[model samples]
Target: MSEGISVVRVTSADLPPLHGQRFDQAIAEGRHGEMRWLAEKADRRQSPKAIWPDAKSVLVCGLNYGPDSDPRATLGMGNTATISVYARNRDYHDVFKGALKRTGQWLASRYGAGVKVFVDTAPVLEKPLAQQAGLGWQGKHTNLVSRSFGSWLFLGEIFTTLDLPPDPPEFDHCGSCRRCLDACPTGAIDAPYRLDARRCISYLTIEHGGPIRRDLRPLMGNRIYGCDDCLAACPWNRFAKAGQELKLQARDDLRAPKLRELAGLDDPGFRALFSGSPIKRIGRDRFVRNVLIAIGNSGERGFLDVVATLLDDTAPVVRGAAVWALRRLAEPAQAAAERARRLPGEADATVRAEWTEAMD
Candidate 1:
């Protein structure tokens, strides 16, 4: 007689595995945008066993990082830069990785040495896997939304060798609501559950390098880092509460930092401010470039002086963005004079071109 293990069957059908079929189609259509890594491991992302077949079941977990106050409430403070809630405190990758690692250790103790833990840094499709693990369903915006946690949770997973019971997949609750889609400033979310990260303000400012697109600059608002418009707009968030993780709580400094102060940061200053945070990965130039875009979109002429300061920045990309911001805030004659002053010192071909364009 075969040994019937105490295996809990979590129907993979309920979750509808992500990369196995739909994800492959999405990537094949070029919808993942500039995140080329998604295309790199196309095969592994399609199956949990493919990542580590050594085991039997998957254990998925969630941590709620929902804010006590409205994430958007501080935007009115014009001088302040609005960082996304997910980024306000210590990096979740570090936080969740520690927790999941401990959980994985415990599992390994119980099930032997065939367990692996993952947060967002793996080939496994976390959102889809979470859904399959009976956590929640992917919302219209393509983010997982839980009935208990609402849309305010961070997902982690454990791929174990033991055949433990699996949780039933949660059902979708989006139900024709387009609030997340409509709330997006850049229309990055083109359709239900489909996002083009290239145009997303969060992606462009943080993940993307080089110049900010002229057309998209005006829509960025004061968001200097990741965007929360889509996440915050969900009606299901009404039930969401403040997170239990103290490390994930909001930081007063990052709540709504002053645009002028942020624009003034040197490389060392930027490093110190975002040390334990995910924002450090973008580096100084890209971050300042983002700040310049925000200054341009602010429509506050008083910020022209701050923009002028970056004209001589070491980075051509930052200098170019500063030129664009100055032009946006300055009077025609003032802008022309500023361009003339910058034309001679602008050694970079790109900066020179931007200066000429501003003069024109």
Candidate 2:
């Protein structure tokens, strides 16, 4: 196909064994955090055969969703939230699913075989399969980096009973570059291709449904959603162009929203604001919790009023996050008064820890 989209084929057996082994190891080491779904369906996640016995070949496809401007440019905007490049647009699962289904239908009709498609929600090791398919090699950042699309491609796959010719696999192009490794804000990418999700800003903001590790909060900066430091640092992305898909383009409202404004969103307001975006999946509580983290990191006196309103949020996690933000923005005398007023009424041990952690 002449279109930017390309499809490559690989067998289930071609899917590397180490991918599953790494999953087990990550789970065993407790690196996955509260995303228990990764461990719960791990048997199926381990291999393609575990999902469908008759599937002989997997057709991996990818679409580029690269940003027009560098995403890392927003990291210094401490008073505002830094949503990830991908989440700044409509959800990829929704935007890419349509293209995948159409492509799958065309393939099935031509090849006369049954097919099933999957994007992120599936248990498939998509990056490994994409690498197996010659879509790209998984760079040191542990993301697929294409010669053409760099690290900005969103992958999907079609499992089929019909066998197809497999393409030559892509090999490591990251020879000496440690830009991705060194750029991580939280040291999440501890070593080449090894990500400790527990220390990742994306996991802390989106998946881990608890107060973030106090030690890592300041390092998180203003990344209220996913962090892109590692991805943005990859030199291969010089080839990336803005995604042509209109639905996948960045929305003006999501680009660089101010922390104070986002901190004030009520339940319905949050839902309505992120209605079509993937950020909505975390719900208002966690979303506000992240905004509060950014507010705490902002070090801006103007956010005091916004953070104060959330001090009594219904969700304990939100309240706890607000406590941290208030402490960061308040002067010594004001913080003491607020701490004295709130400590006795705090019911959750974790929230209480936030108050005590504040004193430290």
Candidate 3:
């Protein structure tokens, strides 16, 4: 059941030097964008020993969360929003952590080893560690690509005092293929194995808190939450099988959610709808902001009224996005009338700029 388990000895000085250099380079170059947390814990993320000096070996586990079908199928459905594959169901952090905690407890009882479990919550570089542990090589998209599981592995780790035998690292198998690079809607993957998060649709929708850049908004299409274009473009996925974990499977409601329905969600409704889902964390305001962006990209005139109603929404971010969406769908005369009516009373500087930008 645990065929994905692999070990790594943190005591080896040579193991982390290259990873550290690349990590530091990415941070120094600001490739991480607004995710300041990545820079905040640079030392701990690069070296496992920095997290726990007593930890001699790390147990890395990869769980398959492959989608049953192609996730990109929703992109053409302009009125329907496309959510990232991983977030279509339960929060992976919760599901993966539970399994890790149980394993940690068992290891403690059997081997008397102290254990610490990490599942995306901590600053540990799970990707580099996963690569070192022979889980898979980090593909051109910078995600772990397993020959058996493709790009659908969710990683978790148990830092323990047990000096377990290490598995050999997997070498890159990307070859000359550049499918993942060309598949980026926003060209976030500017180069092979290098990503600029500032232009990444995933970062723009999730990690970025404020209004998305005007230029990148249209390219986002209907991807309201995260993106999976690069991952879906990987040819290695042909060998991938559907994940057996029922809990991680896509919920029917989330599979192809309508933009109109998503745009109407208030804070309470948003919280209720996404209770166990990872999308709940972004909050109604940010989530709605993303939805409005999708609505704008949708270019469907039917949503003009829906976008107009949100122009009066309490959240400035939502109202700002509403202005953008309205402009995209409304006639020039209708959009001007809206600006004339709302601009005078608008109090927020950013929202006011959105109104002006919409006119442009």
Predictions in order: lDDT? 0.80, 0.84, 0.88
Evaluate model 3: give its lDDT: 0.88
Write the residue-wise lDDT of candidate 3 on 176-287 in tens digits.
Answer: 9999999999999999999999999999999999989989999999999999999999999998888777778999999999999999998889999999999998899999
Give the higher-lDDT candidate: 1 or 2: 2
Off by over 4 Å in 1: 1-18
Q: Which candidate, 2 or 3, would have the higher TM-score against the true structure? A: 3
Give TM-scores for every candidate, taking all chains together and pairing residue i with residue i: 0.93, 0.95, 0.96
Error of 1 at 49 (Å): 1.2
Best by lDDT: 3
Candidate 1 worst ten-residue window by lDDT: 1-10
Scored against the true structure, residue 138 in model 1 reaches a CA lDDT of 91
Summarize candidate 1's per-residue lDDT along 241-326 as a digit string, tens digits: 77878888888888878899999999999999999999998999999998888888788998988988898888999999999998
The clash numbers for all candidates, in the given order, read: 4, 0, 0
List the candidates ranked by lDDT, beginning with the highest: 3, 2, 1
User: How do the residues 140-175 of candidate 2 rate in per-residue lDDT, one tens digit apiece?
Assistant: 888899888888888888888887777778888999
Please list all clashing residue pairs in model 1, or write none if there are none: 8-165, 55-161, 80-257, 81-257
TM-score for model 3? Answer: 0.96
As for lDDT, the candidate ahead, 2 or 3, is 3
